[model samples]
Structures are given as C-alpha cells and as structure tokens.
Target: MAVGALAGALALAGCGGGNDAGTSAGGAGAAAGGAGSTGAVAVKNVDGVGMALVDSAGKTLYFTDQDTAGSIKCTAACLGFWFPASGNGVAGGAVAGLSTVHRPDNGQDQLTFEGKPLYTFKLDTGPGQHEGQNAQDSFGGTTFTWHAATTSAAAPTTTEAPPANTGGGYGY
Candidate 1:
C-alpha cells in the first residue's frame, strides 16, 4: 500500500544521519524545560481546523494516539516525520493544561496538551496545513495516528501570555 511505502521511506530517511531540524524536547506541563530548547506556542485559526496550537512559525500542531500522559512513543525513526513540539510554558496557548514530559529516549522535556505529547507534521509546507490530521503511519515498529491539537481547554488563571513567537516550525 502507499501508506506502507511512505512509512518505509520515512523510516529509511530517519537512518540517513540527522533530521532536517535538530528536534529537542524543552519541557512538558508545569515541568521546567531542559537545555537546547526554547518553546514558543500559540493558538491560530487554521483553515481546515478551527483553533489549534501552533509553533512560533504558526505551523499547526498535532498529537499522536501513541503518546500518553506519562509515555512518549514517537521516537527514533518517528522523529523524522513528527518533529517534537517542546516548550517551557506550563500554560499553553492562552489556556491552562499546557505542560512538559521528560523523554526517556532523549532525556529532554516534551511539551504536552492536557497530558498528550504534541508534534508538528514535517510534510506540511507551512501554517494552515492540516495534512497530518487523521493520518496513519508507522515507524520503528510503532504505529501512530495523529490529530490536530484542539484549543478547548479553559484559559489559564494567570495573566501571563505565552512567549512571543520566535519563528521556527519545529521548536528551536
């Protein structure tokens, strides 16, 4: 099937040395961020999806079914296509429920939404692209179903807004 082939190719690409970007986990939830990460997240009204969390570049954010409250399943070959979304802000996107999770694979904090790890589709050219929504793929023996992150959480009580956009699709 085409999906299988694409997954295979992506997995192979993962073995080609390094990624297009140096993916890093900054932080998750209220947890503090680690070194080599600067997370800046915001909510944007995308075309296909209503309001979704976006990176500094305004690229729509996604979450995987494989990632749980305490587990980060997208690793190794998976990182090629699903660039991790890392940020230090506990309050995500003008709303509460934003946090970080420490990734055992890489020893960094990964940003999460209401406990689910967040990611951005590498294939998406730019902001407003929801190509990753409902997408099915596999890498490194792990199957993943991705969906756009929804901005449905209640607003945070604090007045501090998320950090200003710094202009990188994947957390830089």
Candidate 2:
C-alpha cells in the first residue's frame, strides 16, 4: 500500500481496537473491521515512544519481555489489561518485520512485529497513547516488561499527546 493509504487505514482501524469487538472482517489487524476493528498496523510517532508500530487507531503496540518467540505468554488476568492486536500482520510502506501468529485463546490472528507478539493497553483509551510502556507486571506466572515496538534505535523523546485524528479510520 502507498504511504498515505496506509496512514488512512491505520486511522480508521485506530480506535476500533479498543475493548469493544464490534464486527469481524478480513485484513491485517482487522479480525473485526467495524467500529472496534484493529484495522491495519502502521508505523507512526506516538507520544513518548517516537517512531513505533501502532494499531489502526494510533494506539501504540508493544512486546513483552516475558513472551516466548512465536508464542503468547500473557493469559487470563493479564489479558484483561493488555489486549492482543488482532491482524494479518502485514504492514506496508516503510514498515518492515511485520508478521502474525495464531492465538490459542481465541482462534484469531494477532499482529507481530520483529517476531514479538503485539498488544494494546486498555488504559490507553485513544490512539497514540503508550500507557503500557516500561510497565512491570506479573500474570500467569510470568513477569512482563512491556516495551513499545519501534523501528528505530535512537533514544525516544516524549512529545505532546498526539492530535485526536492521527490518521486512523473505520472499515477497511
């Protein structure tokens, strides 16, 4: 997909991936593609995290230090606050290292970047929020260090909260 098109897709899908699972559809990050779809995965600068992978609604996607490669480690209680980002996991444009994995819990495809399972934080009510970054928590016998998924190695500089739009939209 073109750069602008990817951003638009990310915007539509951005807010859709919240606690609500509205409707099911097909696409990367779009197991459900209505108002609550995960939409598409895209690279964008999120507040406090710099250039990183975000969901359709601009919510920062993260990886847990406790997770095994290609396998999910968070379950039950942990899942309540951290939601798996459902997607086909193919992000176009300058974004690379995109992939997907099947979740045994729900039979849905979860998005992964650079081989780490990606998730969104429930406290982040909107896009571009990185409320889960560097958070330390334990669930299901695992201790997790949540970190934002980034495409760069430069030190991230926190910025003002992202603008409301941030390019995410609904539907496909």
Clash totals for all models, in order?
6, 18
Assess every candidate by TM-score: 0.66, 0.65
Best by TM-score: 1
The lDDT of model 2 is 0.65
Model 2 per-residue lDDT tens digits across residues 142-166: 6667888988745588655856764
Predictions in order: lDDT: 0.67, 0.65
lDDT of 1 by residue, 4-114 (tens): 565566556655523324444232211212122235888767765677788776777889888896878887546656777777653243556778888887786778888
Off by over 4 Å in 1: 1-38, 90-93, 153-172
Looking at model 1, the pairs that clash are 27-100, 28-99, 28-100, 28-101, 29-99, 29-100
What RMSD does each model have against the real structure?
14.1, 14.4
